[model samples]
Target: MALQDQPAYLIKMRAKPGLGDKLFALATEGMEKSGSSDRFIIAREDADPDVLWNMEVFRSHEAKDAYENSPLADELRDEIIELLAEPPMRIEVHPYSALPDGPA
Candidate 1:
């Protein structure tokens, strides 16, 4: 798909009760250390207050793969695992081809 047909890469996370906020915070912070992501959004599941999803958009497959394979990502994954009800699940999505002009 075209770069703009998709985000290049994404990570979908489902958080446990009372820990979504904390996990989200860590995820945001962790992204800075890698510096390869293009956009980040932590969304709460409307049906379940205790559930959350962290949507990450990368600049390219290589960038996303780099982050996924990096020590920083591994560190964050290990840390967040403790906060989850079960092991976090990962989903790769095709983001919108076009993003809004405002800050992502």
Candidate 2:
């Protein structure tokens, strides 16, 4: 498949007041230990410290689906639900990939 059509998952999460740090720590830990994502982009909103945006890219939809249903993912999902100020929002995105002019 062409790079631009690659399937990915984009998530928007909001932590409870004063709990952004804890949420970030948990997410980082999970991403580091997990093989579900080939790329991860995580950012905290500057204006709203309680907001987090995450973009996770995988090799395929199958890989993404597998990771979402794993035991570790289930545990993390439960934990995140408790830490959230409101329900988390997620959407599937097709991203443009493969650096065209870069060394790669």
All candidates: TM-score: 0.74, 0.87
Per-model lDDT: 0.72, 0.84
Global local distance difference test of model 2: 0.84
Q: Which stretches of candidate 1 lie over 4 Å from their true place?
A: 1-14
- Residue pairs clashing in model 2 are none
- lDDT per residue, candidate 1, 1-104, as tens digits? 36554444344566676787887788778877778877777677788755666777787777877887988889988998887787666776767555567875
Off by over 4 Å in 2: 97-104
Give the lDDT of residue 6 in candidate 1. Answer: 44
- Please state the error at residue 76 of candidate 1 in Å: 0.4
Candidate 2 residue-wise lDDT, 39-79, digit = tens: 78899999998898999877677777888789999999899
Worst 10 residues of 2 by lDDT: 95-104
Return the TM-score for candidate 1, rounded to 2 decimals: 0.74
TM-score for candidate 2, residues paired by index: 0.87
lDDT of 2 at 69: 84
